[model samples]
Target: MNKTLQTDLLEIESLLELVKKQGIEYLNKIDERKTSANVHKAELINLDSKGLGARNTLQLFNETFEPTIVSSSGPRFWGYVIGGSTPASIMGDWLATIYDQNPQAINGEGDISANIELETIQLILDLFNLPKSFVGGFVTGATMSNFTCLAVARQWFGKNYGKDFAKEGITEKINVLTATPHSSALKSLALLGIGSNNIIKVNTIEGNREAISIDDLESKIKTLNGQPFILISSAGTVNTVDFDNFNAIKKLKKKYNFWWHTDAAFGGFAACSDTYNHFVKDWGHSDSITIDCHKWLNVPYESAVFLIKEEHSSLQVESFQNSNAPYLGNPMENFNYLNFLPENSRRLKALPAWFSLRAYGKEGYKNIVENAIDLAKYFGSKIKESENFKLLAPVRLNNIVFNISNNRNKENIDSFLTQLNKTGKVFMTPTLYNDQKGIRVSFVNWRTTKNDIELVFKEMNRIINIIE
Candidate 1:
């Protein structure tokens, strides 16, 4: 080993202790941390021939880069459906790095990380009140989760016409139908060789809603002329958090030959609340589903799950199987994640979720979900009452889509959002809804509270007055 590496290894205990102390301090002061950093320029550093060692490197990082780190995980950050990590989740994430176990095989030569992953999947299924007939695995995020599910959906579509797209390549035009899909799902289509433009847009429900219209959806299916297609449905839309009528979709599955997939990333948390469970009623009937642990489970980044029905396991293997490598063994004989999902090598991505689930249980998550929904409603009420702002859609769950009250303020939406984010007390993202400029504020962080709502309301008003 190099001299510097050996010296660093000798001081690993003290180095880790220093990091732990810093982590605790940062997390404790997160509420006061700025949610945005205006400074975009940084001094680029070159690698040194002689190492600085861990201690001096830490000092250098603190001096040069740490100040630029914005508190996206903080309570006031209501941008892009982000969520903060729970205490238990952070603990598990730290351990995952320390262990550095690659979770790929169920009965491998040595590691059993895959077993832990399987257990975590079961825990998630139970939390959502889903049936055991679905087999799930962890992926990087909702994008990859959607890709995994749709890959199998693609294979299944090919099977309906006596073809194996995975083996022979896509020789036919794949039919896809959707209404109000998250951008990530469409990106997945692009990655899966299913052209994003190929999606047949199903009309949404009449009035100010993003949910799919059952009557329109049925009419669209009739146009397919008994062709097998893939229906990508949203359990929670990004703009207004609108959920499709899953009960009605379940009824259509009986008559139509199509693979149903729901992108329930953050919205799936509705299952935790009796008051909100209706949003995803009968969603378990979906052939596949995507849920992000980082968004609503309050786990760290790069965490999501893709669940495909057990009956389609063969199709999944056919889509993702590493058949060329004989060393990986038969894809079907010995159960392995390498043949089940996109990635062949993966970390113990399920550990943090496992820790969070075991630490909080169902009641704790229920409280977290309900608290976020309450905060969103509170914030939405404030927006509705404000003279300068108006809601673009009703507060359906945990997202508030709003805009400036009148046409005069329309042109200022982008500038208003920029100024507000520059305030550093809060952060929000600009969006377009129904061809009108708007801003989206999503509440999924467990630390968010009524006090945070009050703080944000005051900040929003202050920013609006200054902008006007």
Candidate 2:
């Protein structure tokens, strides 16, 4: 080994201790940390043949780059549906890196990490009150999860027409129907070689709502003339957190020949709360479902899962099978994750979720989901009461879509959001709802509380004054 490598190996314990202390300090003072970082241009450093040891490199990183790290994981960050990490999740994430196990096959030649992943998937299914008939696997995030599900949907569509799109190219136009899909889902279509513009728009429910209109959806299906299509439905929309009527969709599935996919993502957490679970009733009936562990399970980044019916296992294998590589063995016989999902090799991405599920069972998640919903309602109430702000939509679950009350102030929405984010006390993202400029404040973080809402309210008022 190199001299620096040898030294790092010798002082591994002390190095880990230093890192532990830093982590503790950050988590302890997360609330006080700035939600946004000041713009600073980093100076480029050239590599040298003589290397700095681990300790020296750590010091250099702290001095040059650490200050630029923003507290997006903090409670006041209400941007882009992000969530903070739980203690157990962080512990599991750390161990995942230390172990560095590549989870692939359950009973293969390597470690049993895939078995652990399968167990974690079962725990997730139970938490969501889903049936055991769905087989799930971890992916990078909701985008990849959507990609995996839709890829199989594509193959299934081809199979309906006596064609193999995976073996050959897309032989026919695949009809995809959706209302208010997340941008990530559309991006998945683009990545899957299915044109994003090809989606047939199903009208949303009448009056300020994002949910799909069942009548309009059925009408669109009628136009397809008994053709097999894919229906992409939203369980939780980004701006307003509106859920499509899953019960009605389930009814349509009996009559229409189409694959149902629900992008529940963070919204799937509604299953945890009795008060909110009604929003996603009968969601388990979806042919495939996408949920993000990082968004609501309080895990670290790059974690999401796609649950597809076990009956479609052959279609999934046909969609993602690595047939060229003989070493990988038969995709159908072994039942490996490599043939089931997009990626061939993935880390123990399920470990953090396993740790989180074990650490906090159904009751704990219920409390978390309920607390977030309550906080969103509280914040929405404040927005409604404010003279300067007005809600774009009712607080559906855990997202508040609001805008400046005065129509004349519409042009200032972007500037106001910029200044608000610059305050460093809170962060939110801007949106366009019903062709009007708006801002979205999502409450998915477990650490968010009534106190955080109060702090944000005061900060928003202060920023409003400065902007006005």
Candidate 3:
């Protein structure tokens, strides 16, 4: 064995202790860390013939890279709909890495870690109060979750015309109708060979709303002339957190033969709170739904799930089954994840979510989600009263999207956001909403509170005052 490897193996316990101490210190001071970093460049290091021991490598990382790390998982970092890791999730993540288990087949040669994944999915369903008819699996994140669901939808569409698209390729020009879909869904279409540009755009509700207009949707369906299609709806839009009228969509589903899918991502957390659950009412009626555990469930990165009704299990298998691998057994009789989702070899990605759900349970997540909604409303109220900014739309859920109060110039919006982010105390994202430049602030982190909101509000006021 190499000298460094031997040394690391001998001192593994001490090395882990050092790491645990450092992790605790960082978590202890996360609130004090900058939301944005001033450093942009780092010198690249070349590999040496001899590897550095783990302790020395840790020292090197602390000296060269640690200072540049930003507190993106901290409460004040609101640039995207990012969520901080809860203690329970971090515990699960560490265990997952240590175990290094691949949760694939149920009847595998190894232990059935996939049972943990299955149980975790059920926990998530319970958290959302969704029906047991929906079967789900974990994936990397929002994009892959959307891809997985849409892939099955694509197969269902092909089946409607008595063709197997997965085996023969997508010979049909598939129809996709959506109002204000996240870019990830469009990218998934491009990845699935369904041309992104080929989508039939549905009109959104008039006057500062991102939800689809029912009248426009039905009229667009009329143009389809009874052809089967895929309907991509948003459970929570990125810019305004706007939700489609699901009750109305449920009515349409009875009359139409199209497959329904929703990209709920972070917004699906609304189902956790009784006060906010109406935004996602009838959402379970969707043939498939995508929600990110990393976002609102407050798990680590690269975690999302796709819930598809059990009725379409055959389509899922047809779309993702690996027929070439005879050793994996039949895809139909002996079920496994390798023949289910996009990736063949997947880590026990559901472990973190499992720990988080078990740790918090339903009421715990309800409190986290409701608290975020309260903070978002508090922040939105401040924005509405501020003379320097005006809300582009009302705070319907946990996001605040706004524009310069008296200035419509794009440069002014850019300058304001730049100046605000430069404060390094808070961060927000710039967006284009309704053909106008805007800024978006989302609240999903568990640590965020009214204090954080007040701090950001004061920072915004100070920045605007200086600019004025």
RMSD of each: 1.6, 1.5, 1.7
| Clash totals for all candidate models | 0, 0, 0
lDDT by residue (tens digit), candidate 2, 1-468: 898899999999999999999989999999999999978886696897889999998998899889988888889999988989999999899999999998988785767688889999999999999999999999999999999999999999999989999889898999999999999899999988898888999999999999999999999999999999999999988888899999999999999999999999989999999988999899999999999999988899989999999989888888887888433434446667878988877988899999999999999899989999999999999999998899999998999999888844667889989998988989999888999888999998999989989988988888777777
Candidate 2's C-alpha lDDT? 0.91
lDDT of each: 0.91, 0.91, 0.90
lDDT of 3 by residue, 309-402 (tens): 9888888888887879533434446667877898988888899999989999999999999999899999999988888789889999889988
* TM-scores, each model vs. reference: 0.97, 0.97, 0.97
State candidate 1's TM-score: 0.97
As for lDDT, the candidate ahead, 1 or 3, is 1
Query: Compared to the true structure, candidate 3 yields what TM-score?
Result: 0.97
